[model samples]
Target chain A: MASGGSGWRTLPPGGIIVEPGSSLRYKTGTWRVMRPIINQDKCVRCRMCWVYCPDAAIIETDEEYVDSKGRRWNRTYKVNYDYCKGCGICAEECPVNAIEMVPEVK
Target chain B: MMGSQPERFKSKFRGILDIPREERFVSGHRLCAGCPVGTVMRMLTKVAGKDSIIVNGTGCLEVSSTPYPYTSWMNPWIHVAFENTGAVASGVEAALKVLKAKGVLGKDVKVVAVAGDGGTFDIGLQSLSGMLERGHKVMYVLYDNEAYMNTGIQRSGATPWGAWTTTTPVGKKWKGEWRWKKDIMGIVLAHRVPYAATASPSHPMDMIRKFEKALYYTREGPTFVHVLIPCTTGWRFDPALSIKVARLAVETGIWVLYEVEKGKFRVTHKVRKRKPVREYLKLQGRFRHLTDDDIEYIQKIVDEEVDRINKMAGEEVIGPVEA
Candidate 1:
């Protein structure tokens, strides 16, 4: 199926993935036009967004954050733009309306 | 992850974030955006833990997760043909048994077999039947997205009645799929599986708990978990409303969350007053052609199913909606 250079013979033996979970190498961040932005100050860290995320785009970091309402969240959830498909489930499922889906600009 | 029984939830609602934080089913795969199975996969691999071997079938999860050189599976996995997921999984379980007996393997490595509705309810049914009948120690999970979603959303045995698909297109003469969705839970129960349950993507906690129960019962025999994952592409809904659609399935009494364990039937998520089926059908493009009478017919079936489960459970597990 190769156009010019190396053909199918160049692929690994048996097509076994030497590096497990190697799909991380192919970034899917470009698939989204609407990127979900998590407002740390408004987030309650209930992990509602994190749990519903299909892409595992919602990264749970060790970084702690205290919201504007004095709620201390042990971990912060950030959108890993690299693989986010911008499905808007995070924004829709967020109980506190902390996640806002804004259009991604080039 | 193995040996000990899964700690059951208490009176308090378990925190969704409190579970194991490891990302076993990592990102960068090719599953559709807002795909319900991705959420299920995250919870499933998280609950199953890393000390398990995942036996995936030729379905969407396999096609998307492992595209040639790249794979999203952090745990050991084997993707086999469409019709022999159970046979392959049984072989893997047998291999594990021999390894343990021979002192080559120490830790209790759980074998999890995952297949789509087509695999479980149709083509692979015989293989699955043999596995369950033989009492293999594998937690068989059927992700019922309701059709052959991997190959352009054709109607399968699991496709519910009155819903449109590529094979069962709605037209002047033909309605949607006339055949009722196959009762897989009933089939698994018939095989006398140690633990069997039906789960929905809307309830993650319930789904995770069911997965845990299935894992725990692997020591006894093969455990079957059937999860209703609303397909974003096939079901023809806004990808964002995936979870909502799943919830509507439960809320409308179309999908029941129950488990059959040691001959005892229990309803997990019970609805007090059920919504009209139209509320769920209206959201999806596939069911857009369903008329009022068509919806009424589906509603009758849903109501009867709710009552049937309630009768089977010997309690008013699902409360009826007073008109």
Candidate 2:
């Protein structure tokens, strides 16, 4: 077993796995400093943030959210902080100014 | 109501960032922080979309992303030797063509070949030229960082004159590299490919437009894109200044942004009032040892090149070339 007990000995010599998406095990969330907060009311469901996120941290959701302004939204976007590197490219590219980067509490 | 909008309008009207997230290159790769290559790769992959195959040459991008145990590419990627990216891409394109003809591949898949300047301008030139001559449907991208950074900042054929590298160190009698940078765009264009362009990571919008144009031209023949990727470590500049340095390269006319489609030249980002070359040269440590005469020499050459490109773009020269 390797350090994380994934049974490395069971694998081939180079730990080669003839598969894809195995990099998902490496969590990169610790790279974040400022987190993106999406304002659903202002969002036009444009998916701009989702597109520009270099880390692919932005996920589209069918679930709706009521903003502080009491506006309801049928579809929204969520930032998967697990992989977001706080690049702020999403906030910079959001056409409607719906995404804001706030200081990470932790 | 928004959903009711025409799909064509939605697709066309959306900004570069408004496109759907189809990331083929994921994070957690080991590219340096604030590295322009990462951004360039991300944006290029986004433009390439999911239905694309990437052929990478042995360079920083390759060595960093794919270690033995892990790989960052979500799309089908093939890693080739430093000098054979273009040859491999041709084979992949040929295979895809056969698959499509035999009804094995039901969808259209784009082929992209990526390499650094060392691979494209020097070692891989033969393969690249062959691929272009053969008219493979591959979009070849050369991320020109000047020197071979991955191999300890050695001087390469693409290293500009008066730039310092390990192999071309500044000595008492000798000053850095004594030769001008190779005109790779000219060499690539000589193949008579349908489309080719020079791009920089600093201008994201321009890069996106150029990539889209290159992809469009892939249907006709092969296309080539040369990107000036600023090397923070090798160039001895702060990592954060990578984009700024790249922008300065364009503003000073050192890196002219232009595209040639079907043998016609057009300057994509025309600088109405170009800055002096020294404004760009002084920022990097590679040019720290340059003398006044050297600076003047560089300025003169840059001005001449800018004039030539502007003339091709059919723009009137506003003022005399200044040193």
Candidate 3:
């Protein structure tokens, strides 16, 4: 494990960082102007939003829920607002018109 | 249960959650909204998998992802200077090979070097050429944003002609970028590497197939993939129109999708009814200053290039060769 060092003399070969996933502290969701609202009623649990999201903001949760139509769903999807940049790619890629990009109120 | 062949050919990625969640490049990085570079990075990382080490050059991808203490990479990653990504990857590959030969490392690992066009086409050409000639078992991917977007949109070697950049501004004396984009794929083919291809983020499956092919060629020698990534800020387009702009680039024959293996040329994605170049150029603000004559000039060039590629692929010439 290497710490912050001054020059190239103390750096590892090829500047390889031994630690991975060090970006957890940086919150990138503040850059979003639009947020995606997933309509569970229209969502077929198809995971289309999960795949097309460039930011990896869509998370698949094991906890199931019932939609407004009283339809039972197995797995649910949630947008990780802490990192989603709201590119609207998820909304555009949704085949069933489930995800809608609405202006961020806050 | 038997199904129709068309049903079998459906997208494998429809069940998106079924795709592996173990990401090599995670979120929270600072790439711009609707930046195709991020999408290309994600797709490449997904295809490369966990048994790989990524070597990134100093550019948008490097500066945005690894800001000092914070890094978005989940796999073993390295950040080298602009000109030496290929060199660094070569060193890493050598080290891994030595460790494996000594029985210290059990599993096989792949080395992938990623760089923007400014790093690859302009600054990093020497090291990239050397690495290719040396036949190192590394995959070099150049995400061609066509400009130095990280340092505020300057004209790069990969920038197409008549496109506005900070350096090549549209003025009375001169139109935006009077020169044509350099033929990087031709240069890579000149190296006579095992695999080389042109890809775009618009076609993910084609890009993924090329990535997998590059991975396969890692056992043979070096593999190079040039990807066209549309930049929303640099290209001066709506953020939502990124994918559409990229798709139009291919449809208009401006960026032909093709691959070269062992000196044989093949057109991967054929455009049946090629759209005119104006249709693609009209979408971006960068080409707003172009006159009808300028547009015609561009169309002529594109058509000639398409004819050349079709001839190489042994496909019937679809576009007019003579302007």
TM-score of each: 0.94, 0.80, 0.88
Write candidate 2's Cα lDDT for B105-207 as tens digits: 9999999999999998899999999999999999999999999999899988899999999999999978999998998998998888988999987777788
- Evaluate model 1: give its lDDT: 0.88
Clash pairs, model 2 backbone: none
Compared with the true structure, what per-residue lDDT tens digits does model 3 show for residues B21-112? Answer: 66677888888887877778878888888899999998998998888667888878887699999899999999999999999999989999
Ranking by DockQ: 1, 3, 2
Instruction: Kindly indicate the candidate among 2 and 3 with the higher TM-score.
Output: 3
Write the residue-wise lDDT of candidate 1 on B1-323 in tens digits.
12456654332226675667788999999998999788999889999988999999889989999997789999998987999999999999999999999999999999999999998899999999999999999999999999999999999999988889999998898898999988888888998887899898788889988898888778889999998898889999888899999998898888888888777888999888888888999999988888888888888988898888888988887778647
Q: What is the DockQ of each candidate?
A: 0.74, 0.23, 0.50
Please provide, for model 3 over A22-74, each residue's C-alpha lDDT reduced to its tens digit, 9 standing for 90 to 100.
Answer: 78678889999999898877899876566556777888888889988898998
Binned by DockQ into CAPRI classes (incorrect, acceptable, medium, high), candidate 3 is medium
Interface RMSD per candidate (angstroms): 0.8, 3.5, 2.0
Top DockQ prediction, candidate number: 1
Model 3: colliding residue pairs: none
Quote model 3's iRMS: 2.0
Q: Give candidate 2 regions above 4 Å deviation.
A: A1-17, A27-106, B1-14, B317-323
CAPRI quality level assigned to candidate 1 from its DockQ score: medium
Per-residue lDDT for B36 in model 2?
Answer: 73
